[model samples]
Target: MKHLRFYFDVISPFAWLAFAKLPKVIEGHSVTVDYQPVLFAGLLSHWGQKGPAEIEPKRAWTFRHVYWQAHRDGVPLQTPAQHPFNPLALLRLAMACAPEGMTPGRHACEKIFRHVWEGGGDANDPARLQALTQALAPGRDPNSDAVKQALKASTDQAIARGVFGVPTVELDGRLFWGVDALDMVSASLRGDPWFDGPDWSRAAVAPPGVVRPPKGNP
Candidate 1:
């Protein structure tokens, strides 16, 4: 089994940031990264959660925060022209490229992310999508029934496995969400003695309040 399963949506700047940082995170480790594409809209619908882009300060903060992190990580940052465009075609294209090899899928993903997020391009444009698929997957067709079905199945599998957001890393039945979790992913890959750490519950103390909080919730 692959040590790291990364789920992403090209619509997410955080996912792009995480994807950019993955090369460094996986370096010097034997862990493998299995990149899987899922629709952010679908996950939000299934989990009854709102996307960051649909909210106020979060939507505004999302872009600013990720750009800061991208600069910090020496990764280029670009915003998309549309806030929440349909990703169906894009997801299918990525899955189509996947059959050829990881590189094709990965490069396709990077190109899409760069063009949409970095170049502020409209991802919903069919001509733009076809050009990417042609270059990345050769004869692959993104709008094909087969590609659409495959992406949907893969996305459903991600949702069933408790994936609720982009840039989620699944390992050993545990899920790590966001770029911040990459450190934990690395630690797990290295078999660190304190990877899971000790249960602090035994040495915990209650915090002041109208009513005391739960053991690890205070």
Candidate 2:
């Protein structure tokens, strides 16, 4: 059996796509998806990268690409009422709800994602968010110290591990970023030589410092 840790931020459209496809991907494969909540803004800050809403063409493309892909893949997706909204409450609520096992946690994550994105609702509205969290977690307090600490720990650990994006999975020291990487993840899990493609392995022969390096490291 393979156990994988899925780090996600509910505000991410791609993360919603991952949630839609995960169940089918792991069915009968003896795999378990551990739903983990990490702040997308936290990742953006640490990586020194701009999010879609903070950029021009990228912001436009993010919505277009997600909707197109979701349609093509038979997944439901809709733009949220607010873009780049604060997700602290949602993140803490997910961690707080997911104490027992994978199913309940995945369900909770899906509910939050669908409510905010697919349902075109405002997750930032405290009363609404609190109601949603209460339904999933029952008495769990997003403002409580325990939930805050857990959320912090998960976000800090995600940064420590190479998770600069949502819908990322970590297993056996291998980090797969983005929903597109799930295919490679499955191949690797099947004990196949997943990277047999020619020359792609050597695509990064030069160090980033010499190969169009970014301004700074996280």
Candidate 3:
């Protein structure tokens, strides 16, 4: 079976928007997706990069772009007043629902995605997250023992993967960095260009390095 690896963080609006179409994309090509929750802060730290606070303009532009892209994808989304610093709890909740047997997991993820991206809800808020989860899984209460167990399992799985960012899709030991690259993932599942390098990196023969005359070439 085709496996599409997905990496994401709850705080990433772009990731939230991309999650909306994952199911549809997978079904379109009859493949399965493996979700990988990551820590955005940790990743940035590793890169020695100060967070978005260091670049307010860039952050604003990113949020705006995410909204526009979400619109293009027909996925409704909005920016939150503040992003959750840690979303492992939410990721665990998502993990519990993503497996084949529990269709509820998928529904729960969608609900949370909407809560974060559309309603501007804080994913780190247990009350809000649990509320959304309950709304989506009427039969299995988010506060139930079963759900707790599932959430724990999901969290464990995520930690095991060394996830440290949002929207990191991996396959064959290679990581695809963002939601915008889903088209490539979809193509892989379709048995086309599965191993081909990313579209952005494909080099069109860098027009033979040109050498100019010393000074006055008119």
Task: Name the top TM-score candidate.
Answer: 2
Q: Per-residue CA lDDT of candidate 2, range 1-218, in tens?
A: 78888889888899889878877777668887788898888888988888888988899998899999899999988787888888887887777775532222677888888877776777788788767866785445667887788887888898999899988988766788888988877776776754455443576475565445566754
Task: Order candidates by lDDT, high to low.
Answer: 2, 1, 3
In terms of lDDT, the best-performing candidate is 2
Error of model 3, residue 174, in angstroms = 2.9
Question: Each model's TM-score, in the order given?
Answer: 0.83, 0.87, 0.66
Q: Residue 24 lDDT in model 2?
A: 72
Query: Model 3, 125-164: lDDT tens per residue?
Result: 7688667656654554444566556655544444456544
Alpha-carbon RMSD to native, per candidate: 5.5, 3.4, 8.7
Task: Please identify which of the two predictions, 2 or 3, would achieve the higher lDDT against the true structure.
Answer: 2
Flag clash pairs in model 1.
78-117, 78-118
In model 3, the clashing pairs are: 7-167, 7-168, 8-166, 8-167, 9-166, 38-165, 39-164, 39-165, 97-105
- Flag regions of model 3 displaced more than 4 Å: 95-104, 122-126, 133-164, 193-218
Ranking by TM-score: 2, 1, 3
